[model samples]
Target: MLVGYARVSTQEQETHAQTDALRNAGVGFIFSEKRSGGSMAKRPALEEMLTKIGAGDTVVVYKLDRIARSLKDLLIIIERIEAAGAEFRSLTELIDTRSPAGRMFFQIVGAFAEFERELIRERTRVGMAAAMRRGVKMGRPTAMSEAEEAEAMRLWFTGDYTKIALARRYGTHISSIKRAIKRYRERHQPSLLDAA
Candidate 1:
């Protein structure tokens, strides 16, 4: 059995080209999904295809990167396929992992993928650090202004509105309201240990 998997990152994208290629390659069962290949949990069709394969079966893809986000991820998926006693095949890369030469090519590709990811991560970290040193805010901005937060806390204490209602009114979340209240008490109120 030659089981195929095709994927695209977003709803606007289509997997038609990949599906056509896989079909032309004579793959009998092709699973397709329009999702970013970032997380394993998000690819249920990929997981199902792997789980359904058995000995003497082969897992096929139009391209290796279509199914894997990084080298570690690709290797992990191959490990799962191998554990199921199945072979791995990629059409564009001409990789058929049942053969020694094909395995070497796969390893070389995986190494380059891992190196590329590391370089990207290093660049992002350097950029963030540089921004921080220049006094630029690095993360998400606050959800509420000081006056609004104060009013929300006052309303909460006076039992005029529930946290959910206040969140809706302020266009924030219950979590933000709760965090504001907790911070306020921690600053002004004595702890039980201090009272003791």
Candidate 2:
């Protein structure tokens, strides 16, 4: 028996192409899902497929990355398959772990995939650091505008509106309302450094 698994990172992505490839490879049963390959815990379909595989069964995937993003994860999954008396095969990479050379090539491909991911992470860290050095803000923008914060602060001080009311009025959470007031206080209050 050939058991296939296909995956996409998000709901916006489709696994049609991968499933088609698996079917073309003579896989009669396939488990497909839209979920990140970043973690094995998040992929229930992959887990189900692994459990369904038995002796003399081959686990097939359209690509290696579709099954796992890191070499450690890839090796762990392969070990599980081997332990179940099953083999592994990848269509795009032409890797079939039924032979010594095939297993070696599979590991080599997994190593490259892990290396590429590390490179991407390193580049992203460098880019974010450079942007920060240039005084660019790196996180999500404030939910409330400066004018809105000022208005919230003024209303809060007036004692006419409660925190919940301010949140409802601003269409933001109570936490945002509290933060706005906190920012207002920080801006207006004289600090110890200023007193010195």
Candidate 3:
């Protein structure tokens, strides 16, 4: 049995090209989905297709990314297919894991995925370093002004109010107050050491 799976990120994006390719490849059953790959849990048709496929069957996909976004996810899906005693194939990538050459190709792909991740990490480190050298500030914009932060700190140090109370008085969440307290303690660590 040759089972096909087709997917598109949005309803506006057509699946005709994928379905047509699957039909041309002689798929006996085609399970189509219209959802982003980011939300794997929301893919009902994909889950159903996996449950329905059995031994001696082949699950065909138009492309690798159409089924899964990352190599980790692709490996997981491939592992599931193999565990079911079935084969996996991608039409565009020409990856047919049922064949010996296909297995070799998969290994190569795995190496490439690792290499790509390393390259991304290196590039990100370089970019961040460059940004720092240029005095570019990172992280989220401040939710509280300097005056508000000072007032919050003063109230907190007085031990007259709980963290929750301070947050309520400042019209902010408790989490914000907690973070502010943590930051203040870290900044004043030298003073604390001297006092001790």
Tens-digit per-residue lDDT, 74-126, candidate 1 = 99999999999999999998899998899989989878867887899899999
Q: For model 3, how does the per-residue alpha-carbon lDDT over 131-171 read when each residue is reduced to its tens digit?
A: 98999877765557878988899989999999989888989
- Model 3 off-target regions past 4 Å? 1-81, 90-94, 168-171, 190-196
TM-score of each: 0.71, 0.77, 0.57
RMSD of each predicted structure: 4.0, 4.4, 6.5
Q: State the local distance difference test value for candidate 1.
A: 0.89
Best by TM-score: 2
Best-first order by TM-score: 2, 1, 3
- Whole-model lDDT values for every prediction: 0.89, 0.92, 0.85
lDDT by residue for model 2 over 25-85, one digit each (tens)?
A: 8999999999988889989999998887899999999999989999999999999999999
CA displacement after TM-score superposition, residue 158 of candidate 3 (Å):
2.8
Pairs of residues clashing in candidate 1 = none
Candidate 3 accuracy as lDDT = 0.85
Which number leads on lDDT?
2
Worst 10 residues of 1 by lDDT: 138-147
Q: What is the lDDT of residue 83 in candidate 3?
A: 89
Residue 188 of model 2 has an lDDT of: 92
